[model samples]
Target: MNQPHTAQDDGVRQRQQQIAANLRALILSGDLRPGDRVPSTSDLVAEYGVTDKTVQRALAILKAERFVEGQKGRGVFVTTQVPTVVRASHYPVTSSEEPYAWIADNASRGRAGSIVLLHVGEVPAPAQVAAAFDLEIGTPVTVRHQLLSLDGEPVELVWSYYPSNVARGTRLAEARKIRGGTPAVLSELGYPPHHAIDQVSARLATVEEFIALRLPQDMPVLRQLRVVFTDDDRPIEVTVMVKAGQHFEVRYALPKPE
Candidate 1:
């Protein structure tokens, strides 16, 4: 039997959909640049004269679409760089499941999976990290840092963080033990993320990243930050992956407006 949506449910959905449309337009028109701060929930409520819950709904929708990402205490920001020309039909949905798989596949060809996991540990969360995970600052968090290689050549560096309480004693942590991908681990936690919001940008390689990727002084690197969310509209994970720009490319598949 088909059930009807309640008034409140309908209102929430409409507001969120509206927010998604407006946010997309802002990004595509370049009104919001990479790393630019987005309006806060309070600001949106005032500007749109909507309830706080309504604003949150909108932001949640944007997050699901990869249009914006929330930093722990850093609020949200426009994604840095998005490929201008790619349609949603260009690549398979699961083509690059892991954070760095896309660049690894393109740069290293059949060798993207050769990278080794360096350090994986649980530690106290920073202020920003805590906010992203909706936890108290100083809370314990699980952090995983890894290095990537291409045919024996180092090419990328990545750091991934998750709420320890949420991931501990679950398949998510077990998957990490087995070197399985984060998305799969998240699925085991009952929050299987099916979509991601990603932002890409370029910058001079940091001394640390340069040493890690073994890039020359003049080489730049690509930075990608992604937030993964469950279908029920909750944030699941956030990842930061960096790669040598000289050997990397970012691609996306956007659906054309009818």
Candidate 2:
């Protein structure tokens, strides 16, 4: 038989959740504006009739979610920065006419977007990457990895891969940021993206993700796999994207069967 919860344990959990809910509502409802200090533990405990630990637990939840930040020698305050909103790979790339496909999806929402190209080099393709690019595992592929940020806060990480033969002498092989974006260069190389397949999933964050995405160990990562194919159905590029789960909302639109 399954174990049953003890009344004492249940009561503790409810009280903690109740404190968290009250604080969360104040923060989200704009009553607690950014840069404003949260209630001190003593104040909260006395007001809620809960212990100090219970108040701390409630604040911890908000801290983990990045709803508030704690300062050294000072109390916790509402977060001043807003999370960046991003559209997933399923969203249409900025039209070719737009001139810079590297622009982020949040640009449509009037948020300033930036791509910081971190690395560029050839690495033996991993199994999933090889399969997506129709290359044998361990085959070398030119890779470009970057971090996307909005308003100076990171929003996502991307790893874009290209076949060695395809990028060997091209601009894609360079270790610097690409201007005019990937599609512009692809079009220059006669491999303009004509179609793409995007796959979305969730999983525990890797150590690198935990560090780079600045996510809590318990937070899941939102993963996006996008393979850009030429009109002839040849995969020219594959991009793997991971975002901090709480900071993103992924949406997709599907068509009716023909």
Candidate 3:
């Protein structure tokens, strides 16, 4: 049997929520600007007449939402929000206007962007992935997997899949960072990317992802399914991108209809 709700329980819950709301308001109001240190837990508890645990809980909420981050032996400081353009219909991959799409999107924003090669190998595609590639289920695809970081903090997980035939005997088959970018490699192979289709969705982060991104459990994430095609409309690449929800926003620029 379950116990019924009690006034005492309701009061405690409300108190916790109130503390969180008050701190969130302070941050949003610019009273606590980015990089500004939040009050010590003891200070907040005493000033708000709340328990130490209540103050901690409130801080935890802010941390999970990426509003503030705690440094060991130091104190919590407001975290800077990273503005990311997750999707741009016009910024095709082969634009080759930059070293790589990641660098253009992240490094140009004044944040150090980096990619750490995680895994690269030929793997059998899942049913949906095969369908996307117009191949039989379980067909082999070259998978280039890596982790993306911003300002030394892991923010995104990326995996680019290529048809085995298209990837064989190319630099994409190697487990090393591609020079320039993958688009450059594709162009060298005579099949430059022309345009792409992008789909974005949000979901709770998995345990592995929680550890990878140093994110709180139950925090939502943004997942992108991107397909890059050639001028002739041949799909050449499919990439899966998983990013921290608090760190990104997707925007699509549609061409004005004639």
Candidate 4:
């Protein structure tokens, strides 16, 4: 039989989570930048008014997630693998003279970005995707799944779907990385992306996501479902993007009033 939960156990876990959350925020905000030494255990214990075990447990959480590392005698320091901030609204605007937006975005940040096309085939649309494309449930759609990497580290898993008629004989249906990404190809086919809507959420990683991302644990993942529209407000594409929640953040810029 499973042991019953206790108040003492709950209290310890809460303290551990609190300490971890504070340190994680500091690392993500650049307050404790890469290579910066985390406060010594004694210092953290004093700051948080927690026991040594609590502090150690918190540090262990961060270490496992790759946020910090321990030196032989130097205590823990923030890792070089800082979380990536994604400029959500800007990365989709492609230029003919430059690489695809994702590549250019990473390149601008001095990181090597690459994409690997994992699979391509006709599949029945998922319910949400079907709604986005105005197709009935179980309607056929061409799906292309790819792995996106930054500095050779797997970052995001993306699945893009298009109406079968729109992708049947196009590069989007092929099992190869597109020269300019699908946005440019869609433009060539007269379905230029006019705009898009994105919905983002955070949840526990699915088994597939956990393995694909090589996560250290069953950590939360950010999922963004985007629907792209072309002329006449017709939906041309639906995409699902998944990223490790602890390693990525999204930014959106709002325009000021005139």
Indicate which candidate wins on lDDT.
4
Give lDDT per model, in order: 0.65, 0.78, 0.79, 0.86
**How accurate locally is residue 232 in candidate 2, as Cα lDDT from 0 to 100?**
80
In order of TM-score, best first, we have: 4, 3, 2, 1
Off by over 4 Å in 2: 1-51, 68-85, 89-105, 256-258
Candidate 3 worst ten-residue window by lDDT = 2-11
How does each model score on TM-score? 0.54, 0.72, 0.75, 0.87
Residue 111 in model 4: lDDT:
91
Kindly report which residue stretches of model 1 are placed more than 4 angstroms away from their true locations once superposed. 1-108, 126-128, 136-138, 171-180
Q: Cα-based RMSD of the predictions, in order?
A: 18.2, 6.3, 6.1, 5.1
Instruction: Give per-residue CA lDDT, model 1, range 1-258, as digits (tens).
Output: 534422233454476666656776787667887798888887776666667898787777666545688999889987654532322222212333445444444454334346567777777886656776788988888777778765566777877778887777765444243333566556666777766677788888888887788764445678877667687767677677787664455656566999
What overall lDDT, based on C-alpha atoms, would model 4 receive against the true structure?
Answer: 0.86
* Number of colliding residue pairs in model 3: 0
Clashing pairs in 4: none
Which candidate, 2 or 4, has the higher TM-score?
4
TM-score quality measure for candidate 3: 0.75
Write model 3 residue lDDT over 1-258, tens digit each, in one string.
533322233354457566666776787667888889998987776666767888888888888777889999999998876446555464435444565677666666688888899999999997657878899988999999998898888889888999999998899999998867788888899888888888888998988788888875455799888888886799999888899876777887677999
Model 2: residue 88 alpha-carbon error in angstroms: 3.6
Please, what are the lDDT tens digits per residue for candidate 2 over residues 1-258? 533422233454467676766776786567998899998987777677777898888888888778888898999999975544445535345464554454645666667767788999999998888998877999999999999776666768999999989899989999887666777778889888888888889998888878887774356788988888986899999899998776776756666999
